[model samples]
Target: MLGTATDAYQPVERRLGITRRIVEVLAETGHPFSVVTKSAGIERELDLIAPMAAQGLVSVYLSVTTLDNELARILEPRAAAPARRLRAIRALAEAGVPVGVSVSPIIPFINEPELERIVEAAVAAGASSAFSIPLRLPWEVNPLFQDWLQRHFPDRAERVMARLRDMRGGQDNDARFGTRMTGEGVWAELLRARLHRVARKHGLRTERRPVELALFQRPSKPSAQGSLF
Candidate 1:
């Protein structure tokens, strides 16, 4: 919930300790929350997170798209390296925090080939759950992705887009509520099946563990008056 839709641990937020401050407030208020991030920076909050995790109030998911260092560097230049993410998973799990992996935006002929490998690596590093979403190129992202694809994978750029279209019902993206997150058609079904099998084999759940809401305590309002010396 923290970083899947929008990364709260972005470079600037991390540098300013914004995300950490948020976590501090959550911890103080006993509010349960989940963190999804591709940054290894989450490790820095283990002191606060570990205790909450002990009460089933928190969980973490690390997004890892590929295991190949070179490919990862080019694809997610700003994110942490694949190996470092695995380490983060291990660190979280060892501290008794329930951790998972999100192999999101699975691009065909690109990171898709390494889906199982990425999950396996995460499991080995102590991940207990996993999930993924196919790549979606909506609006401006479609052209931008195409341009990048042509530049980096000119040889298979067309093929890749063609296959994605196959999954998206002949379009670059399907914005339908039911089908948007999980695409339709043969290719999408195949991806779903593959992920299910691998997740089962690794004893990893395909869904995130639910956090406890019963422990939530409403944060008290701050005083209107300034402190007097």
Candidate 2:
């Protein structure tokens, strides 16, 4: 819940403890929530989360883009190693937590080839569900990713961009709600089909868990007098 667009437990969290406190608060309040992160440090918060999981109030999604460690380092220099994330998944699953593996930003040609293998690894590590989305390049991200591709993968950079454009309908991006995450076109449809096939083959779920609205209690705001009518 706390981590969606950005990582909740980045390296700074180890020193700051802000995300841990947020998880602790969520556990205390009995709010059903989910967290998505690319950090192994999330394991440090299992003490707060496992009990919440018992109430169906917590789920975790570990973002793993590629199985190749070298590629992972280049892709996310600050993120935890792939093996460590897998270990975290196993640990959370063993502790009675419902874990999901998020194979996000599935870069065409670069990491897309590992879709099935990544799902298999997640399932093997005890994940109960899996999900993925193809890579999208917005304004700034578009140029940056392009530069990176050119620098690192000169031979296939253009081809990769072409494939992405094919998915994005000859543009750098598709902002439509239904097609934004998965794109649109023949390649996009094929990518979605493959992801679904892999998830089904591995017995990983994509359904939403029922929300327990009864357990939600709005937190009280602090006041100068510490009391209010």
lDDT of each structure?
A: 0.91, 0.87
Point to the candidate with the largest TM-score: 1
For candidate 1, write residues 10-40 as lDDT tens digits. Answer: 8887569988988998998899999989999
TM per model?
0.94, 0.93
What residue pairs are clashing in model 1? none
Best by lDDT: 1
Off by over 4 Å in 2: 218-229
Ten residues in sequence with the least summed lDDT for candidate 2: 220-229
RMSD of each: 3.2, 2.1
Residue ranges of candidate 1 with Cα displaced over 4 Å? 221-229
Candidate 2 lDDT, 1-229, residue by residue in tens: 6677789987889999998888876776777888889988888988888888888888899998999999998899888899999999999999998999999989899999999899899999999898888898987899999999998889999999999999998998888888888788899888888888998888878764454556866556634563554
